[model samples]
Target: MTVTASDAHSAVQTLTQSSDTLFLLLGAIMVFLMHAGFAFLEVGTVRNKNQVNALVKILADFGVSAVAYFFIGYWVAYDVTFFADANTLSQGNGYELVKFFFLVTFAAAIPAIVSGGIAERARFYPIMLATFLTVALIYPLFEGMIWNGNFGLQAWFEAKYGAGFHDFAGSVVVHGVGGWIALIAVLFLGMRNGRVKAGKHTNFAPSNIPFLALGAWILSVGWFGFNVMSAQAVNGISGLVAMNSLMAMVGGILAALVAGKNDPGFIHNGPLAGLVAVCAGSDLMHPLGALFTGLVAGAMFVFVFTYLQNKTQIDDVLGVWPLHGLCGAWGGIAAGIFGSEALWGLGGVSLTVQVMGTLLGIVVAVAGAFIVYGALRLTIGLRLSEEEEYRGADLTVHRISSTSND
Candidate 1:
């Protein structure tokens, strides 16, 4: 028995492919768990009467998102289809399958983010329809433009600014777009009933602080894979990405503590804001730059959340606009600034392109959100009946409660 050099080389190639597949599989699992974070976060934030609805909505949205992505969204974004036989699909040790699983979690987050904004008063089926359309058409169009180079947008950015718009992960592409869309949905849905009366706003206290904190913790822990494993190739992983993520997380926590005046809700969500702001630049910015970006995002969340709730009268339940929309936009632009040679970064970004791309994302998100939610509002209606609102969504929609009183 003898083994040739060519055989040895083939074996090594197979080994590397298997390792890459395994690494991505782990990343996908971690990201899938973030939906649990989304569910629990909404559950703890809404009133007790609506907790069950929150849990049910997140799970249902994920299922719908998976279907949407599998049938149409994936093809729209990547020009790839899964219509081949098992042997063809199983090539690369089924890495594409896991990759789809990974990316679908991101697409599903569109609805999850919107869920937090409009929780407690939305109809179940209407929201489901919105999630399907978003994942199927709206989100994927932009995703294709940015990630897959579908529309020559990246080429235009590169030609104009000497670098393409750089969202190493999906800061502007995923989180920013979701956040902006959620804001529109919240606005179109209007404020929660009795939230304000005669120029006085009432406090809607969280149903369970512990669950909110747990949600934040889960998201924070899983974000390492979210950011670091974005490399998608084992050899491309970097320790710097991990270090920057850590620095940003702590930075967000401290800044939110000071800005929110030690409010537990803000404290828990602070790390998330930081993580959101750091995702775009984690591969390029210095850790200190990432820390600064996180600090700004934390303070921004605290201040903007207060202003929107009190002054503008937008009842964004989890402050999704400030947390994901504003911070994610900031992350996109920050990558350009902090990723420049002048800022001690790796220097492969263009500030002009970043600003342009971020603004484009926001515009697309706002338009899509209004079109979808507005159409729903005018046609079938977006919110529940006044009686349902007072009775609570869990009982009205799900006919159940988080606690089994019966």
Candidate 2:
């Protein structure tokens, strides 16, 4: 029996809508749990005095992402056209679900970045404002360019070349963006109380390694969701992605153990480093390649942290730089290295092009964060007063009770 053209069109449309809804829902859930990961990680870094504030801020980040991404960031970061095609868009997509997961993770990342910069001393309101700008406005633009398949900068790059800036997952898009913003905030905020001396520094303390360790573990778990689900194909390639993600994590752990010749910052950031390292190439790389990438990531984290810590007096409460920035660059470069003709052919895309594309993303992400944050610093005054520093952001900004139970 021959079907009518109108009936066929209707059936196809119905199927397309159904599948898109499923994928959107899946993406949303994966992105949502990332908030739990951020909360644990931030709370762990702080002294007990600030745990309540950290938890509250973390929860607020989720709310911020949910509303901002839905109302604004989603459209800014994602919805656009590729070329001169009027009425063009991504395949069978809807805004609500795309951002449900992607922007949630994006939003959480900003607060995660801020956690290190203002950890022991920041006022909640300023940090919250920065989070909004980073996710709601600044982040959306970069994200829009990267993922907005229609008329984004990334879409233009893909059109010029063969494939888009193949971030398989977001390295520069999420991690690097947050890392730069955090770096800017730290520059304006300066070090915490007594972290520096006359050009030198006094004693530095985590004050709670257990909390840090717990956050690291949660991050490791949540990161699996982050990586595996990024296999947008769900069934076919997800297993390979999961294998690669674990391999990089293992490689990072091994490298960290070795790096802990005497100091154990490697242990703290081991899994975190691996997750960031493989982000660029997770879908493309084999397990062995991911392991090697992870090893490089672990070493990179150690090297960047040691050099930065000694060189600059910046007080990153969570050391987000080594985890996100150094390793994010590694993720992009790894895409160039591990991207293979044997596995997933670039269909003739040059390694140089891939690497350039990745670097281009870095340029955009860093520049965007720097400009917005610099302006925000000048206009609103990024950091709190000296009196507020010792008091903690919880007490100074929100003026809430500080009981451990609360």
Candidate 3:
């Protein structure tokens, strides 16, 4: 049989498409595993009585987030929907569907971040409702603005500044937004019962250090897929992103070790803080720049977490605000700095634009959180009763403990 040029071209296209599809699918699967990291992280940090609730909340939030994002959030962000027939949806080897899967994992992370902050005190159903609202509506608004270029926000930034805001992997879009929103949810829920006594913070050490370490390890491993695969295509992948992510992780570990006074929790979270910061610039930075960014983020998490716990009444369990929110913001700004060619980076970022973009993310997060959590607080209540709290959410909500003996 003779093959025509058109047929040959078509065959090559099909092969490329199939390869890209498989690449994205693997990336999506790796990110999907991060949810287990979130679950275990929360489980280990909260008291033993609340461990089961922590595990349940992460999984439930992911389920709700998938539904919300599929039906609503994807449309809001990319102006795309999956209402078509299966054949139509599966045209590109289901690449688009896997893309949605990858992104929905990010969307689900907002509620998981909030889960840690409000754990042990929040009611289950209300939190689920909040997750639905946030993933379906609030998160996608900013996500569209930055990622999809939906509202001309990126054009405006480029017009005013030399370059548009450049968050290659969602330092602001995901981590920053999640962290700030978690802060507000934590505030609305208030401190857990007996967390403070007469204006003095009480010590609530982690329930399981091994579990905490395991969670951190899982997140760290999966983060390679999270940052590297943001390219979304086989042709677009870069080793630079992988390298920067590694340097930043080590920087965070070492900095946190020194700054956190060798605390195990701080040590574990240090790498996360670094990873969160490097996400914005992983593709643009020199490895050394990423290292410095990680160092700053690691130390910042320890210091800010300590300050918030000691100096303020904000009872943010697991310090999501410090780890994700503030470090995420730093990552955004650091991209502008370390991503500049002057600093041995790839360049094409404007520091001014990054600052503005970072602040905008924070504003959106704070306002959206207030609207969602505040409404929940006023209408159905956001917290468990004091009696329920003392009994722990595992018993009050799930009717099971982490361990049982017959």
Residues 259-288, candidate 1: write the lDDT tens digits: 999999999999999999999999999999
Model 3 regions more than 4 Å off: none
Model 3: weakest 10-residue lDDT segment is: 397-406
Each candidate's number of clashing pairs is 0, 7, 0
lDDT of each: 0.92, 0.69, 0.93
Measured on C-alpha atoms, candidate 1 has an lDDT of 0.92
What is the alpha-carbon lDDT for the whole of candidate 3?
A: 0.93
lDDT of 2 by residue, 17-62 (tens): 6665565456656666666666767766666666677878878766
Find the candidate with the highest lDDT and give its number: 3
Write the residue-wise lDDT of candidate 3 on 249-300 in tens digits: 9999999999999999999999999999999999999999999999999999
Worst 10 residues of 1 by lDDT: 397-406
